[model samples]
Target: MRLRLRRFRPRTGPHEHRVVQPLHPLRHASLRDPDPIGHLLADHDGLNRLAGLFSFAAYSRHTVVHIPLRDGVPPDEGMGELVDLVLVHHSYGLRPSQWPGLRRRLTHGTPLTVRTDEARTARDAAAWQARAHRADRRDELRHTTHARTFFLFGSRDVFAEAADSFAYAAGNGPLHKRVQQGDLALVSAIPGLRQPPGGGHPFEVLICFKPYPPYAHFKRPGR
Candidate 1:
């Protein structure tokens, strides 16, 4: 599900390589606090402003989110305000009376919890590309990883360390839809981003305001 969005055009020698996200400053803003969940919601009002888009429906857990393209505002404007990836909870367990083919993935046992950490592996260009496709697939073949991380999780022990090798599952698609996860962040695709209340130079900018830090699937340095 590739959504036709706008992008930024370079003005000089080479194209700028500045990447941004939807949930950033807020991530470290309250780093001294305890509640990771609360820290995740510091500037949630920005995300809440997009309630009409995200939700937690299926999956081993019902955690869902919806990404909204502010009408005529192009992705470059809302990049940091939202993410470009997600976990694969879409076609999971389903009840015959509810969603037959999708109700068996999470059998209603103990709610699963995911543990997140800074992905050092991503710093390696080769490693980053090896797992790039699965990190934050807003689409099947389109990708870009700048400020990504490693989202680790497990079932039996919600607090246990993450699985040996984990990845960000893909979602339905990125056009006219809602909710997803990945090394996703809301960065301004184009240079001049102008959204409500926070429009400025660079045309637009990704405000680093996500539930988790962007997860880079890892790639080769100069890829």
Candidate 2:
């Protein structure tokens, strides 16, 4: 199925801060379309399609996906750009049912209370670190000598800032620090939407400059 792109502008209000309930597992599964990962792994065409979506969101400044905090409250404004990019990158892995709600939250605004506490935040940060390590290991095994490094961030502001830094470093940095041609400086932001090893997040962002040959396919018109 072709993925449709839409602009999202979330609304926020003081009284909208109530926690939204989670959906039942079977019901949730029923709402999702077939996993796009299968298509992505199938060939470069699939990968390029995904890259197109990313370019669209980045250039258009559209928040195509929304990942609420654990309590269903939207992430702060500091997370706007990074959050949109991260979620769009991972949208192929999300359920269709989840998309509607996420989009609604983004468009309608879910100002309901921010339920995160210090302990929860710390735990989430640690979990994010562990996930980043795993991603590092995977890259190492896949690329061997060419494996890229993972940069982890706990704060939303820093994570958002790193997006720009990565872009600059990827294209114009010194040889040792720059991302090589055909590779991408990518960001992985986890919302902990799935269960166990996958779900629950301190909503951390992890950036890496890694091999991605399809990078040339989705460049903006003039650039």
lDDT of each: 0.22, 0.27
Model 1: what TM-score? 0.20
lDDT of 1 by residue, 188-216 (tens): 11111112346342221122233333424
lDDT value for candidate 1?
0.22
Query: What's the TM-score of every candidate structure?
Result: 0.20, 0.23
Reference-based lDDT, residue 42, model 2: 9
Most TM-score-accurate candidate: 2
Q: List ranges where model 2 is wrong by over 4 Å.
A: 1-6, 9-100, 103-160, 172-174, 177-205, 214-223
TM-score of 2: 0.23
lDDT of 1 at 217: 35
**lDDT tens per residue, model 2, 1-223:** 1233333343344322221221111110000011211000101232222333222322222233222212212222122211111222221233233333444564333322212232333343344445644544221100000011111112322222223333333333213223334333333322222222465542233322333334344442234
